[model samples]
Target: MNSPLTIGVFDSGFGGLTVLRALLPLIPGARYLYLGDTARLPYGSKSRETIARYALSSGRFLLEQGAEHLVVACNTATALALEDLKADLPIPVTGVIAPGAAAAQAVGAAGHVLVLATTATVQSGAYTRALEARGLAATEKACPLLVPLVEEGWLEATPETIAVTAEVLRIYLAEAMAEAPQATSLLLGCTHYPLLKPLIEETLRRLDYPLRLIDSADATAQAVAGQIGTRAAVGVATSTAFYATDSIEKFQRLGSRFLGQVLPPVSLIDLGG
Candidate 1:
C-alpha cells in the first residue's frame, strides 16, 4: 500500500483556514497538516525581511512534520517569501497568487480589477504584476485593519466594521472607477478578506457598483490538485489536525470562524528554532 500523501499548509494566522476549508472538500482522502502562526499574527504590517523569516520558520516546521508538499496560504507570505521558501524547501511548494491571478485574467473583462489585501502584499505589487502579466490592469488597496477585525470574530452587521470596510472600499473603488468605468471585478486578495465579503458586497451595492467578487481559495485548491496529481490514492482522514505557534485557543477560535466549524484538536509547536 502507498503511503498517504500529506500536504502542509501554513499561514501567518487564521486566514489560511479559508483556503484549507475550500481544499478539503475538493481533495477528500488526503492528509493535511495546517499550521497557523497565531503567536505572530498579522504578517501584513511586518517588514519583508521579518515576514520572510517567520514564513521560512513556519514552512520548515511543516516540512519537519512530514509534509509532501507545501502551500503558502497567506497572501502576505506568498507575496514576500514564497520564492525564497520554495528554493529552500525540498518539496514542491505553491502559493495562492498565481492561481488567483490566472483566475482574474480568465474573466477577460476589459476593466480595472481591484485587489484588497495586506500592506505587505500590496506593497509588493504582486497582485498588480500578476494581473498585468495576463493583460489585465489591476488596482490594489491594502486593508491592514480588516484582518484584525475578522480575527476579532466580527463577521456580520457590525456598523463599525462595516463603516471602516466601506471607507476602504470606497477609496479603492472610486479610484478604479474613475480611471475606468468598466471596472467591475473585485478580487479579495487576502484569504481573510473573504470573511468580510458580505459587508463589502453590501457596501458596493450602496455605491451602485455591481462588482463580481473573486476568491482565490477555489482556484488555489485546483492548482494544488493539479500539482499533486490526485491519482495517488490517500487515506481519508475524518478530522484534520491543527498546529499553532501561539495560543491554540485563539487559533481554534479564529480558525473555526474562518472555516465555519470548530477545528479539531490543535497542538502547539515551537517553530522558534
Candidate 2:
C-alpha cells in the first residue's frame, strides 16, 4: 500500500458520501474517486442480476480511473454483488456489512443487535447473517422513509421538521425494540442513516433505551484505514473526483451533507440505463 492510497468508493446514490466523509479524515491526502449511480438508484428494489450489472459497471469505471482498492459503500450492492465485484475486479474489494457487523462484535455487547436499513437490505438478510456469524442475534427493520427525508433536507433543526423526524424515529425504534427487547446495539445499516445519528440517539434517550449506536459508514471507513495501515498524514493535499449517473446538480447539492464538506463540480457520467 502507498502513502496516499487511491481508493474508489461506489454507491447507488449520495448516501455513501458518509463513508467518504469518514475516509477523508482517516486517510487524508489520499486520492479518492467516487461514483454515485443515481440513474439506476434504489438498488434495493432492483433484482440481484440488475444490481450486479449496475454495481459491476460502476466498479469497472472506478478501476479505469486507476483505483487500486474498491469500497462498495452501498449496502444493497454489498448484500447482492460483493462477491461478483471481487471476482470481476483485480483490486481488493470491501463492503460495508461485514465491517459493520465486526464493529458490533468488537463492542462486546450482550444480547441481540438491531439493524436499521432499507427494505431491500433487510430482505437480503446480509446484516443478520453477518451478525449471526459473530455469534449475535439481530432484528432488522427497514426504515424506508428516512432516506427520502434525509435527501429532502427535512432535518433543518426547525421545531416542526425536527419533531417530524424524531417522531418517525420514535415510531420505528419503538417497533424495533418491541420485537427485540434484548438488542443492546443499534447498527445503522444504511449509509444515509449516519446523518440522523444524533436524532436517533436523542430518540433512544427519550425512550429510555441505552442501546449502543454503530454507524456503518464509520465502521467501514475504519476497516479501510486499518487495511491500509497509515495514520499519519503523509502528503500535501488530498484530491477527489465525483461522478454521478444522473442529476449532477442534485447530487452535488445534497452530497455535501453526507460528505461533511462541499463537493467540487461533479462530472456527469452516463453508465447507460
Candidate 3:
C-alpha cells in the first residue's frame, strides 16, 4: 500500500541478517523490518508444527508493524512452514529455498549439487525436489550441530565443531561421490552456513575436491529485489524497521556477525500478542 515499501525479514536468529545485508544494498531506499526470533531460536531441531506456528506468529507480527512484504529468511522455517505461513498471511511471502534451488540450477546441470543445511531443512527435501524439478541432481546433508556452533560465535576454531563439520562433510562427499561422480557445486542451504565458509573451504581443500559454493543469501536477496522492483533514491525513507521476539542485545550482537555491522536498533515484540 506504500510507495517505497517495507520488507519484513524473519529468522530464527541472527542468520537472517545475512539476507538483510544482501537485500539492503539491492533495495537501497526500501525500509526493512527484521524480526529475529532469538528467544526460541535454532528452529532446525524443532518439529514442523512448532516451526509453522512460530513462523506464522512472526509474519503476523510484521504485518501488524506495517510490513509490505515478507521474507522468510530462515531455511528451517522456510523448509518447514513457508507454504502454510504464506496462506495465512495477507501479503506476498517468499522463502530462501526456491531461490537457492533456482541458483543451483543456473550454475549447471548433470553435476551433483550438495546441499548443506539444518536437519529439518534436509528432512524436508525441498532443495532435492526443487533441483530435480529442473533436471539437476541434488544431495542434501543435515549439519544439525552447526547452528549451535555458529550461535556460539565459533566460526573458525572449536575442536568439537571442527570435528563435527569434518565428519558431516565427509559423509556428504562420500554420498555425492557414490551418487554422482561429477558433483562440483555445494549449496549453503542454511543461511547460517555461509559464516563457516572459511572452515568449510578448508575442509574441502583438505579433501582435495574444490567445489563451487553457492550462498543462498545472494540468491534470496536477488529474488527479493526482483519481487520489489528496482531501488529508489537514497534518503527516501522506506518503512523498514527491526523487531525481535526476545533479547534485543543478543540479536544485535549476533546479527552484526552476519551483516558485518551493528544493525539499527531493534524493537522487542511478543508475537503472541
Candidate 4:
C-alpha cells in the first residue's frame, strides 16, 4: 500500500482502547478513527435488536468519517451486531470473537479452552460457539467484577486494591479451571482484560493452572493487519482521532489507562438513541 489505511473502531466504552493499543504497534501506518458510544453504554442490558441498532449507528458514523474498514471492539456489540454490520456496511468488518477463537487455535490450543468474559458475553455464549466451530471445546466464565475493578484502576494500585483484585481473579480462575480441567488455553474474552494479563498469569501460576493466555485485543489487531495486508511501516507513524458520545473528560482519563498512553483531545459526538 502506498498510503495509510483508514480504519474505524467502535465500542461501547473505554475498554475498546485496548484494541486500539494493540493495533498501533502492529499497523503503525494506519489512521484510526475510534468512536465510543459513551452515552448509551452498558449495551449488555439492552435487547439484541437495540444493540444491533446502536452498533449499526456507530459503524455508520465511522464510515461517514471516511473509514475503509470496521473493527467491532466491544464484545457485546461484536456478538450481537457483527453480522448486521457486515451486511449493512460495504467495507470489511471484523469482530473480537472469531479472531480470539482463531488465536487459541493458532497457538495449538487443543481440546478444551477456558474463557473469561463479562456476564453478558458469557450469557451470549459467543466464545463457546466460536471455539467449538474451530473444533475446540470451550468453558465460559463470567467475571462481572473484573471489568469494574480494571476500570477503577485496581490493578497495581494500593496493596489493598491489588490484593482484592487478585483474590477475585483467583476465585474466578479456580472455579473455571475446576469446570474445565482439560483446558490448555485461557482466552481473555474482554478487551479490558489485557490490562489484567500479568495478574491473571500470576494467579494461574499460584493455582498451578497452566492455561496459556490469549488476549482478544492482540488477536483482533493481528486479524485487522491480515485483512489489510500491511504491517508497521518504518518512518510512517500511525495517527488516531478519538470520538465519544458523552463525557469527553472521563473518556480521556479512563481511556488513557486502557491504551497505556495519554489520549488526545476527544471530540464529543451525539448519536441519539
- Per-residue error for 12 in candidate 2, Å, reads 0.9
Q: Estimate the TM-score for candidate 2.
A: 0.96
Native-vs-model 1 lDDT? Answer: 0.82
Off by over 4 Å in 3: 156-181, 231-240
lDDT of 2 by residue, 48-164 (tens): 999999999999999999998999999999999999999999999999999999999999868589999999999999999999999999999999989888988888747788788
Please list the C-alpha lDDT of all candidates, in the order they appear: 0.82, 0.92, 0.82, 0.91
Per-model TM-score versus the true fold: 0.91, 0.96, 0.89, 0.96
Indicate the TM-score of model 4.
0.96
Cα-based lDDT at residue 88, candidate 1 = 92
Structure candidate 2, residue pairs in collision: none
Q: Which residue segments of model 1 deviate by more than 4 Å?
A: 157-181, 232-235
lDDT (tens digit, per residue) of candidate 4 on 119-226: 888889999999999999999999989988988889977999999999999999999988889999999999989999999988889899988899999999999988
Candidate 3, residues 219-249: lDDT per residue as tens digits? Answer: 9999988987875645685455677888898
Return the lDDT, model 1, position 229.
76
Model 4 steric clash pairs: none
TM-score quality measure for candidate 1 = 0.91
Q: Candidate 1, residues 1-273: lDDT per residue as tens digits?
A: 456678899998888888998888776777789999988877888888898999999988889989889999999899999998988999999999999988887776455687877778889999999998888888877766677767765555487765766676567666656665666688889988778777778878878988777888777888898877764444545347799988888778768888889888789988772
Q: Single out the weakest 10-residue window by summed lDDT for candidate 3.
A: 231-240
Find the candidate with the highest lDDT and give its number. 2
